[model samples]
Structures are given as C-alpha cells and as structure tokens.
Target: MDFETEQATRYQRIIDLLSPPDGTPTSTAKLEGELEGESDDIHEAITDLIAFGELELVNSSQHGRVRLHQPTPSTKAQATLTDPTEYVWHAYITERDGLGRTRARRLFKDREVAEEHLKQIVNVETLTPVPGIKKVWCASLGSKGYTPEYAVLRREPVFQQADDPYPESR
Candidate 1:
C-alpha cells in the first residue's frame, strides 16, 4: 500500500489494540509485545495519536493504559502535520587527555562558536566538529550523566597568529 495508507493502517491497529470493543484496558507492555518488531512505527503512531488528542495515557504503578482522547477540530488539524518541533541541532565538544580519557565537554548553541572554542582549548591541528540534536524533554528535565551522540559536521583549522605561526620561533 501507499505511505499514507500504511500509516493510517498502523494507527488503526494501535487504536484497535488499545480500545477494543470489549472496553478492556490494555497494558503498555502487552501492547508493545503485540506490536512486536514494529516498535518505531508503534511509537510514531502513539505519538501522533496523542498529539491529535486521539489517545491519552493512564499511568499506574505497574503499567500504563492507552485511553481514547476526545479532540477538538483544531487539535486534529494540528496532528495531521507530521513535523516535530521537539528537536533541534546542537554542537558539542569532547576533550580527551593523552590516554584518551575524557577531560572536558562543552555544549553550544551556535556551530561556529563551538568550532572556535574547540580550536582554542586544544592544540590539535584541526577541530573535529560533531553535530547532534538536543531534545526538548531531556533539556527541560535535566538528565544526569547523559552524553549526547554527534556527527562530524566539519573540520576547522587551528588558529595561529600572523607573526607566530611557528610557536617554536617565538
């Protein structure tokens, strides 16, 4: 089937799984197990449903239940758009010692600033720029000891003064 059809089918499957005609509450774990290997699709469907106000989470001590959420026309319209606003590009620097142990790490909003700072702090010939995305939830909740993954955006040359290009000459 087509992409939209497939997505709609997945959404319907999730809805049917959660809100069966019997009205029995399905636990999150059970729903996950039923969905099996299609975790990503299931996650996206649930997120979309929640965003559209078609689903709500009922949290319990053991497991959560998915309940139907009655939505207004506006919310349904907003949910139809698939673009997510919870993620943004971020720049990060990881400094390692001679033994390759992590020495320091810094995060920056601007990519150029991060590259410049990396060039100054460490005496490497080039700066290895790492690109990543910061999530709104993690930033707002303040994770402890959690390091984000990054991709290499670009390499920057180490700065050198005009007269003192060779430090040994000075």
Candidate 2:
C-alpha cells in the first residue's frame, strides 16, 4: 500500500537522478525531492549508488557535487608487458621515455601501431610476449596486465584444405 508507493517513488527517483550515470553529478537534495519522502530515502539511494560502484564520494571542497566515477585502467605509468591483452591499445595513453629523461604518451592501436609506438619506448624494450620478435607490444582491453598472449601474429589460419583466402560468397 503506502510502503509500496514509497518504494516505487524512491526507485524512480534513483533512476532519474543517476540517468546514464556516466560521471554525472547528483545531489542529495535533488534525490530527496524527487523521491517525495523523508530524509532517510536519500541515504538509501546513496547507499545503492555506492554498492553499484557508480558513485565517488568526495568532500564538498573537493568536488562540491556528488558524482559518479567509473573504474578506468591506469595509463599514466609504464609497466612490464608480460601480458598486453589486459589493456586496450589506444584506450589508455601512458607516458614512456627512452632514457627515463624523456616522457611521452604511449598510444597504439593494433600491431602496426604498436610496433611504431614501441620504437619510441627505448632502453630494454621488446615485443609483447613472443620472444625473438622484439619491438612490438599489444595489450588486451580485458583486464590489468592480462593481454591475449595466445593470439599469434602473422600466422595463417588453419583451414580444411579447401578454402581460399578471399572466396566469393555463395
């Protein structure tokens, strides 16, 4: 009855407050007004946001607004490429240096782009994982330091002995 109505209102309020939830700022007062309930509803909605990992609470002096902060990979520093698929090629841009004196952003797209980028990261650098194929690094956008090492580069696909490279569609 009344409780159901209150719950529905609160739920709708949260949905409307965090629409898209892409680093958008929302205030407690706005949520409370939208819920059309007492002050406690705001707390509940905030709790929900935290549990969902969509909200980044900061002091009023810092943000001055309640907003969401999605988890993004670190692309500021350089790390070992024991794996690369764990990171996106072009998504995260990191600072690299040849002699640790120069610094620049490392943004590569595919194997070709990675080769070019690797040329810039000098001083004890090599290919992603496949040894003897130095000067190439690729990372997966899946997780941290978990690149797809299984993927072989420049390897021919195994066919059933009756396939053409570019066959016409039937």
Candidate 3:
C-alpha cells in the first residue's frame, strides 16, 4: 500500500484499539509492538489523530493511554474563548433553577457587586467562572438589546508562575 493509504489504515486501527467496550488503556510500548511499524510512524499517526480531535492521550512517567476524544459542553464553551483579544473582562451573576437550567443572567461592571449578587441568589459553590466575555467593538450598550452573561477574563499567561509578582494588579 502507498504511504497515505498505510497511514490511514494505521490510524483506523489505533482508533479501533482505543475505542469503548474494551476501553483498556494501551501504552505506547504496547502500541509499538502491536502495530508492527516504525515507532516514528506510529507516533506520528497518534499525533495526527490527536490533532484531528479523534483521540485523547492520557500520560504519566511510566506509560500513556490513547482513547476516543470526548469533549463536554463546558469544554466547547472554553474553546471559543481561546482567542483573548476577542473578549473583555466582565463579571456575571447567573441564576439557575433547581434543575441546573439558567434562569437569569446579569452582567456587572464590578466584580464585587456581581459576587455579592451571586451570593444572595445561590450557593457560592455553584458560581462557575466563565472565561470568555465578548467585547462590543462597534456600538454603545443601548444598541444591544440584551446584556451578555458575565465571565471572568483569562488574562494570565499559560506559563506564568503561580506566585504572581503583581497579584494586586489582577
């Protein structure tokens, strides 16, 4: 078989091997043994599958498992916020019914006000900090019919240290 065809076949095999019903965690060493190919090719195929979001890798020092990628609703929401430039910092108070459905959403200019309002409505534990809050680049507040739900702006760099030098600035 051609290189592309062979690679495709390998990708399918890996997907099948990692799929549910068995769902057993397969290590890289095991995959190398089972696939009967160059270790590089197998690793590349695994990377490609992960890039395509068809597979997820769970890893530790000793071994790793490849599994079918399962993304939750919250993950989907967070994905939209990956681009920091598109959003602004805003605080929101989301009131949800007993069934966990969102009943009301209110945006606040100040974080403390939003927190206080949220405290009065529901348990603090239920207050989820949404990361992305879109900015209105073009028009004033009056132009928009409804207020956007509040979410905390993720301003910290991924590589920043836990003990931020300027914590007060945040």
Candidate 4:
C-alpha cells in the first residue's frame, strides 16, 4: 500500500481499538503494543485523530492517554460515521445443504471472541470433506443509517490431512 493508505489504515485501527462504548481512555503505549506499529507512526496517527476531533487527549497520571467520545459540537454532524457502536463483529460460515450451500452468521459484541471462533474453524483438521463444511470467516459489520460496510478481520482455509493410506511415491 502507498504511504497515505497505510497511514489511514493504521489510523482506523487505532480508532476502532480505542472507541469502545464506555469511552475508556487508552494509553498510547498500550495502543502501540496492540497495533505492533512504530512509535512514530502511532503517535502521528494519534495526533491526526486528535486534530480531527474524533479523539481527546486526557490529562491522566500516566502520560499519553486518549479517550474516544463525542467529537466537539462542531463535529457532531459527523459523529454517526465515527460512532463507537457503529461497527459490530460478525462470524460467518458457508456450508452445503441438501441441494445448495447455505450461509450462517453469528454476531459478537467483542472482536476478540469473533477472532477466536474464526481461528477454531480454520484450525480444525478433517480427513475427508466434512459433510457440509465449506468456508468460515470473521468480519466487522457497519450498522444501518448509512452505506453498509464490512471489513474482513480474519480468514483461513481449514486444515486437512491427506487421507491416502498408501503412499503413491513410495
């Protein structure tokens, strides 16, 4: 990705991680650790977000803390697009039914839980094509009142072991 796109992605990730409904303040150090991003890049993103009024710097005992709250009244009109509750985690699976494939989805309040479920599905080993199992993944879904958006968080092919008992190359 180009520099601008990469920076924007990092900024979005920072916002998502910090903007829980409770309006909790997160330490800059913790955000850096979570994002596994360079200190300079993370700080730059934080600065840009602060300027945008999507985040507020907190004067906490520990240095470098920020909290996500309603932006200034001037920016309130734009809040819906950046609201904490706007995005929700969704876990989805596609499977073969009697004649065609069916898709199933589960909603999660926590991103970590959805990710764990995705991992479980992808890590399972099947000797044969498991009867209806097709594909599984987890993503974040944007709520209504605007264009629906989805961000695929995690996905991987299900692990399978070769079922051939006799070796062809032996």
Per-residue CA lDDT of model 1 for 1-170, tens digit only, reads: 01355556676777767543233445667776888776556655554444333456555457556665422112323343234222222223321111111222445545566555544554223432111211211111113565421222222122122222222223
TM-score of each: 0.34, 0.29, 0.36, 0.38
Question: Which ranges of candidate 2 are over 4 A from the true structure?
Answer: 1-12, 38-40, 61-64, 72-170
The TM-score between candidate 2 and the true structure equals 0.29
Candidate 1: list runs displaced more than 4 Å.
1-3, 21-24, 60-63, 70-170
Model 3: per-residue Cα lDDT over 47-151, one tens digit each: 545433345566645655666553211222334344523322223332111111123245554545655554555434333321111121101111155542222
Best by TM-score: 4
RMSD (Å) per prediction: 20.2, 19.7, 20.0, 21.7
Q: How many Å off is the CA of 132 in candidate 2?
A: 50
lDDT of 1: 0.40
Q: Judging by lDDT, tell me the better candidate of 1 and 4.
A: 4
Better of 3 and 4 by lDDT: 4
What lDDT would each prediction earn against the true structure? 0.40, 0.37, 0.41, 0.45
Count backbone overlaps in model 3: 0
97 in model 4: Cα distance from truth in Å? 56
Task: Please state the error at residue 37 of candidate 3 in Å.
Answer: 4.5
CA error at residue 55 for candidate 4, angstroms: 0.7
Per-residue lDDT, model 4, residue 9, is 74
Which lDDT tens digits does candidate 4 get at residues 89-157? 545432211111113345666767766665565442221211111222222233455432222232221
Name the runs in model 3 displaced over 4 angstroms.
Answer: 1-3, 21-23, 37-40, 71-170
